[model samples]
Target: MERGNRRNALWLKQVIVLDSSLLIAFKIKNDSHHERANALMKQVVSERFGKPSITSYIFDETVTGIFVKSKSLRLAVEYGNELLASLETLEVSEEAFREAWKIFSEQRNRRLSFTDSSTLAVMKIHDIGRIATFDEDFGNIEGINAIGLV
Candidate 1:
């Protein structure tokens, strides 16, 4: 592909809504996918993927992961703060909660975490179809596309 075509392809993909797992992977240096995740982040931020946003659930998860998984609490806090500063925080609204509740209740065979559903709800509200997530569960959903695993 031509260089312009490649750039256009990447830009036309979709907005990226980052899940906790992917954000944690980017935050914690030890994460196996850190390099790839970091490269993705660099491109997304520099190129501008319709302004990235992370649900509050994901923000909490990142901080908790750092505290629980990292070797040093101080280091974890440092990185956690850095990550928090960078993200656009999205609060879970009543409508989002209701939507998530409906999605979970309708899916008898699958279990969706309230947090995960909330993230999906945000994407739905914002008209975002793409997400950065390590979990494969999002792919099972009809409208949203999980870009990280792909």
Candidate 2:
């Protein structure tokens, strides 16, 4: 499918990849984008954006970020457990990791992190065309729509 068509199809199916930035914002009340994240999550739960999926890399990043920022291991574990129970978590295969490495090496201008590259790889491998993210880096990527960014 064409990129636009794929995005439209994804929208109709309510399928989107979840990004660590969005997760962090939603979990951290003091975050600058907390309110926006909450609103987006509410829409997500209502199926306005379809079902959200996350890769293992994103889960690690989110839980680590929460713990680092909150300094509360309990809160981090709680959030992690909630996510494990509520969201569909995709594993990053070895193929995806190689693809991510390629993307990371090929990018000279964009500063996408290794985990972000892994997310992109996972999305491509899974045929997912949309992502819910607060990170602006995703805006520069083609063939995929980045939602929840202002």
Candidate 3:
């Protein structure tokens, strides 16, 4: 196979966990990561890559974060609903929350948010290796790699 085709095939085998930072960047026009997030969206829509997934907690975080940062409940609700309707949202069980809480409690030095902890928990559960995010913290993680830079 040609190099470009090989890259596309590899991309097809990957599943990316959608992080709040990328979603927020796409939802808000003025966000620093907007352009890169837009490019990622194009890839998703073009189906050149694997479908994206997000945990229920990440969904909540993205929606709430959008509202908090944008100060517009309408945009938040609209984007939240759109994501729920479109994306493959992973569930957050008690076990998952417990795992996330454990990580949050233990990672005092990392300052990882409970929401980010939930993302980690969900990604581990689903065996996902890549995260669509602008945050550098994901880069510090063991199993997961972050994509979609600012």
Candidate 4:
């Protein structure tokens, strides 16, 4: 399916993207944001933030982060599998990639990674207004509500 079509197929307005930082914190017990992640997750489950979703790029970042931090391939795989089974994983389109590259190239002050740029691009393209993230970078972006960030 085409990227736009795939996005439109889902309920966009009520969808909230789950960022890597939030996922990592939720999985890793030692993470400082662990408790907050749990609380945010409860809100998500209660439908306060709408249906939870994640991009393909976020899935990669999350699983890799879990493995690197925990040094447990089994744990990472388990969490990855759980995510794949539970959440709606949206694939980033070429148009979104181009937009992300543009954002990455144009940003001079805010140090956002390519993945972060991609998240923003995907959200904009899909008209997704909310994100469950612990990353402070998303806080300043207009039209996006960065949930779970202080």
Candidate No. with top TM-score: 4
Residue-wise C-alpha lDDT for candidate 3, range 1-150, written one tens digit per residue: 999987755653476778888888888889988888898988766655567877888899899989998999998899989998988887888888998999888885586888888888877765678888888777767777677753
Q: Model 3 — which ten-residue stretch has the worst lDDT? A: 6-15
Model 1 bad stretches (over 4 Å):
1-15
State the lDDT at 25 in candidate 1. Answer: 81
| CA displacement after TM-score superposition, residue 127 of candidate 3 (Å) | 1.2
Give the clash count for each candidate.
Answer: 0, 2, 0, 0
Worst 10 residues of 4 by lDDT: 4-13
Per-model RMSD to reference: 7.2, 4.5, 6.4, 2.8
Comparing candidate 1 with candidate 2, which one achieves the higher lDDT? Answer: 2
Residues 14-99, candidate 2, lDDT per residue (tens digit)?
57888989999999999999999999998877766668888999999999999999999999999999999999888999999999
Residue range 34-138, candidate 4, lDDT tens digits: 999999989987878888999999999999999999999999999999999999998999999999999999997798999999999999988999999999889
Query: Using alpha carbons, what is the TM-score of model 2?
Result: 0.90
Clashes of 3: 0
Q: Highest lDDT: which candidate?
A: 4
Per-model lDDT:
0.74, 0.89, 0.81, 0.93
- Off-target runs (Cα >4 Å) in candidate 2 are 1-14
Ranking by lDDT: 4, 2, 3, 1
Compose the digit string of candidate 1's lDDT tens values, residues 14-36.
45778877777887788888887
Query: What residue pairs are clashing in model 1?
Result: none
List candidate 3 segments past 4 Å from native. 1-14
